[model samples]
Target: METELLSYAFSGLLVIVFFISIALAFRFSDGHVRLRKRLKSRLIYGLPVGSMITIVTVLAVYLFLQGGIHDWDNPVVHPFRSWSYFYPTGTVASGFAHGSPSHLTSNLTTTLILAPIAEYIWGHYPDGQGGTNASRDQPWYRYPIIRACVLFPGAAFVIAVLTGAFSLGSVIGFSGVVFAFGGFAVVYYPIITVVGLLVVGVVRTILDGLVEPISFAGVTSTLPGWTSTAVQGHGLGFLIGVLLGITLLYHRNKRPRIFELFVALLIYGLTRGLWQIYRPLGGNEFVLYRALGVSVVLIGAVLVTATVVASKRPLFEGSSVTQREAGVISLVAILAFLIGPGIVTNLVIIDYHDEPADDELAVEDYIIGYDENAENPTEFVFDAPGTDETIERTSSGVYVASDQRQLWIMDTSQNQLRSTGTADIQIGGIGWRETVTAERDGLQVLGAQSVYAVELRHDDQLVTAYESNASTANIRIDNRSISFAPDIDDRFTITVEGSDGVEETASIPSVNESVEIGGIMFRASETNGTKFISAERDGTVTTVAQEE
Candidate 1:
């Protein structure tokens, strides 16, 4: 796991421990009434239910992790199946395999956030006494803590399982419940339609952060690329949110009129048709989809209009709308809906059509190079005397480019290929290791995979090595230390304070981007205040120092 992720793991473990503590907590209060109330509020979000579900989920996951089964495709039946037949206490894998800290946080937070709200909703065990509702604005429902404790977490488990989310290690967030909330809200959307819609969008975006992209026929899912950030989960969440919104709408209406259901479908179809123009719709798929949309909308509109027009009479006039009139109004609304969604959709089509992928390269200038020999290519060097790219070096050492993408650390010493970016460096017996991290993990062997190795006689032999504060661009010799600059020729000043209390600062004017100090070499990108030249391959960067 990455170090950054590990940094956040402690908090995640705390959450897990917290849940276990809650489950074991005995409800021993002053009396039965007091005990009931106390336990109810404490585990307010159906903690018992959530804890039970999450414990099972966590245990199953622990088994997979312990068994070294990280990938989802390779099915590893967890202990639950085994407990029923094979073993009693099941199994426990030695090493911690719940992934990094970020992973833990994501999963834990999901439950903490969603459980309470879901439980609150499910707590409808009425006390058989109606609260004051003289001229009622809102109906009252009793909050039954126990019932909520049972259902909310149960619902969450069901959602998580159906989505194939909890089983897979990829998604680790509470967005599923958020989606369910949106779905639930859809049942009451018409009353506060705008607020309802916004809520749905917010929920969708939050959940989408952890799910697969919506892969409908015409929906290309350009949402991620558009953000220039990898948050496809939000897009998925948002889509689920849309379904939630619809659900809320349905619920508010209370037993959806069949005609209205068809109308809603019509609106969806028309919108989809408009989406197809910009997105990839296979051969007859486009025409077929558009035809369906158009047809559905037209039928829905006509039906709605007929219903609204036919239901013109309220027997007790002005008290409320008659069912027949409401139907006619719905029919008219459907006609309008069929036309409106497609119009807005068509506009989106115009915006997206003829456009390239969101991830298309937009850089104006760039420089790319590789090992010419392609055999034992370790380091790359550039030397220009006139270019006053004053790299801070007592004695001239090699400097390679950094930051502007590709990194080629040439072992100018003996042309030995130390390691690439993604290889894991394994350490067994005493030995020195030379390794560099590239794009992804190339060597994923068990334990620590070695990028390069040097002989160390004993197992615990200590090898003194310096971890650079910055990326290692080049090495420069000071009296005793080595320093580095940003690139081949960068003016980013690096100042070194020697052991003798003497400070020496060097400034490269142009073309000499990197240099070392004492024994430490700073990587180019992280070299303080360094920037690459406009002509990246122009061999040097200009150093315009404050003094000069």
Candidate 2:
């Protein structure tokens, strides 16, 4: 406890020093002149109230709605994902809901840094300037407080809803909105937005260190971070934000340099994983198009550059619309094309006839089961033209399916459950949540597959959902083979089968123990980091079962 306290104190001190150094640098830099002048003129009027309110709202959703306050690490995530267009609750809450505390913190941290910059571009006062407009003829939106509190927050909420609605699949997290903030900021301050991205990385690292000053980990397997990313959702949010920013710029008669805009868009796309265009081939498989993704990013940068910096002259000799206007129309068309397919896909009703497993446990509307290489219950089935390859995909894991929400997902993969030994699935709606724990117990045997059983526990109700067949070892003693099998009582038993058609069964002995069955003594022992069971008969010993 004392060591932890000291580590926290040291981390806090380091954070303070880092911020102080930043302050000192800003104080000495000549670039602070305009910022200082703006600050002095606006005083508290220019404060990022909208950004603060948005951040607070997101935090509140995570804390209360997602059950983060009760359990900081594990939140009710499955129910809050944007599962389908039919599920209104999920679609609405998905924008604010987070899968984990780290996810929420990383997103909010980026928002904390970039949102204020985007808000600054919007400004608190009307006329696109931070100045008091006391004229009665001024519109209500021109009021500083109204713009700071209402307009900015309202626009942000709209953006969030749009992102959720257009997202490709059942997606959760505030990253889409974070990317929107980046998109908006990059339009007005291209280079500064890049700098802000670096700052975000530093801040997130500091925060992680503060939370866990020391962490120990062993080599483990996990899917690549980019594999699961919703790149289409991110692209949609960024494009929408860029459109909004460009519209505002046009109205304000302002345009950033073409080269700067292109560079910023390209860099941001590459760094933020927007260039990771991929398609899920079900199970844990994905096909990534790296070359095509990079090409798309390059083309996007060029299009955005032309949209913002094109000349006011007509596109051709006698065209009425200007070149910039044409570019804007083309950009809007591209957004429509990107969103149309998602809308169509979401409208299709989910068919819930597919059963995940024969031995599924029903809790309310959820079906929990264990299966190996079963078809994904929630995956949308569609055939690609001119493709002979089977698009059918399979998953092997503990899965949870909900017909009402159109959710079919593997809550924990087989290998993951094997490594962790246990997993928890959180299910809930509006005001209530329940947890179902999946536990795997297994016995490894030498030269054979492991014998295992999967059990589910909800509250006090425990059930063995699935069990594997008994596995026999290759090594034999006195023409007798040893096999391991899982029993209904959640215990493993060792069976000795003799060539003479005699069999003896007994519970597997613990380490350093022995059990005599049919004149053959089975002893469990460990040596040189290997645990094995040995059979002794007539003063002769032979290895039977060993840990894989």
Identify the leading candidate in terms of lDDT. 2
The residue ranges of model 2 lying beyond 4 angstroms of the native Cα positions read: 1-6, 19-36, 39-44, 128-136, 281-283, 348-358, 379-392, 510-513, 525-532, 546-548
Q: In candidate 2, what are the lDDT values of residues 473-541, reduced to their tens digit? A: 877877888888988863788888889978889987788999997668989898896668787899998
TM-score versus the correct structure, for each prediction:
0.28, 0.90
> What's the alpha carbon RMSD for model 1?
20.9
lDDT of 2 at 85: 82
* Distance from true location, Cα of 62 in model 1, Å: 6.6
lDDT of 1 by residue, 1-548 (tens): 55445534644655566567655564433465564563454344213454456545554553343332343332222211111101111111101123333333444444343333333333333232222122335333223333334445455555543232211112233334444443333222322222433444444544443332232366442332212111222223323433443433333333444454444434432432222212223211211244543554465435533432243367366758875546535544533433332222111100111221231111111111122222211111222231111111111111122222122122221112222222222111011212222121111111222112121112333221111122222222333332323222232345555668665555432334444433333223313433332111124432212110
In Å, residue 468's CA in model 2 sits off its true spot by 0.4
Lowest lDDT sum, 10 consecutive residues, model 2, at 383-392
User: Whole-model Cα lDDT per candidate?
Assistant: 0.31, 0.80
